[model samples]
Target: MSIDIALYDGHPAGGRRTGARMLRLSSPGAALDDALARHTDPARHRLGRIDPYGDTLFDERDAGAVFEEATALLARCTTEEQRAAVRELRDLLADCAATPGSRLVFLGD
Candidate 1:
């Protein structure tokens, strides 16, 4: 099994809250993680509203640079499996970007 990080549509942290599931990434998604963090820096300059983290929910616009940076990171990968994961991440980001009001709701365990 692999450690997976699942993205949801909104804040779905508590046991009582619910959100739509979006994307799932394999373990050691360092590049993706870093890209997400850089994009969601929460600083005024970054245009984010929260701290730099892949929490339980987020707006697609909030993590705006994630896709580009992740794709750039993918270009440096050396393995087929890693490339595959990046491809999946790229597709997921594309889908999320195209859909307005799309929110990220969870970072699966």
Candidate 2:
């Protein structure tokens, strides 16, 4: 199983600076373990600590839930642009599920 990981920048309201790297793993159990190891490894110098908040990995089941949630969110969008952005997010989530190993990242502001 091949895992694809990506880093993204994001900021939450009234939150400190932060960053995250998303990890998509084909083999859920094994890939999750590997991702944790890589995150904790000092040599890599990637992340400081794994933040539980806003951090999640979706397997088949979780992916389904996310799809539903994303759809609902998209439905609430008032503008076409907002809807499109939500649609893109939905597609990314779907791609992560489809790929054997895939990941995504949302960095802090």
Candidate 3:
């Protein structure tokens, strides 16, 4: 399945964090997404201990940067489909960035 990027008011799965999801670079494979997310900031958007195996992709702080990186990569990939994804990601990032307690989470890798 493709990556599902969304904004949550609090921690997903009924956890204890408060934030929203935003900014998704590309619906690439899990390996690619992890590599990109940790590319610039190694310890930027990391999950919690609950996910010891790192099964899911969750980035709380510095999420905007991660999303920004993804968006930047496709900034010039203006094909119809690419353009839609880019625009959607950009809008989501902007919305979350403007929101106070919004956290951008990239699911499915």
Candidate that would win on TM-score: 1
Best model per lDDT: 1
Candidate 1 lDDT score at position 45: 28
Q: What is the TM-score of candidate 3?
A: 0.50
Q: How well does candidate 3 score on lDDT at residue 36?
A: 37
lDDT of 2 by residue, 34-98 (tens): 33333343343222232323454344344444666666656555655555555655666677556
Ranking by TM-score: 1, 3, 2
Residue 28 shift from truth in candidate 2, angstroms: 27
Reference-based TM-score of each model: 0.52, 0.44, 0.50
User: What lDDT would each prediction earn against the true structure?
Assistant: 0.50, 0.42, 0.47
State the lDDT of candidate 1 residue by residue for 1-109, as single tens digits: 2224445554334333454544454343554444434444455323233232434444577445566755674676566656666666656656666656665433433
Model 2 Cα displacement at 100 (Å)? 2.1
Worst 10 residues of 1 by lDDT: 44-53
Over 4 Å off in model 3, which ranges?
A: 13-61
- lDDT score at residue 15, model 1, on the 0-100 scale: 39
Positional deviation of residue 41's Cα in model 2 after best superposition, in angstroms: 34
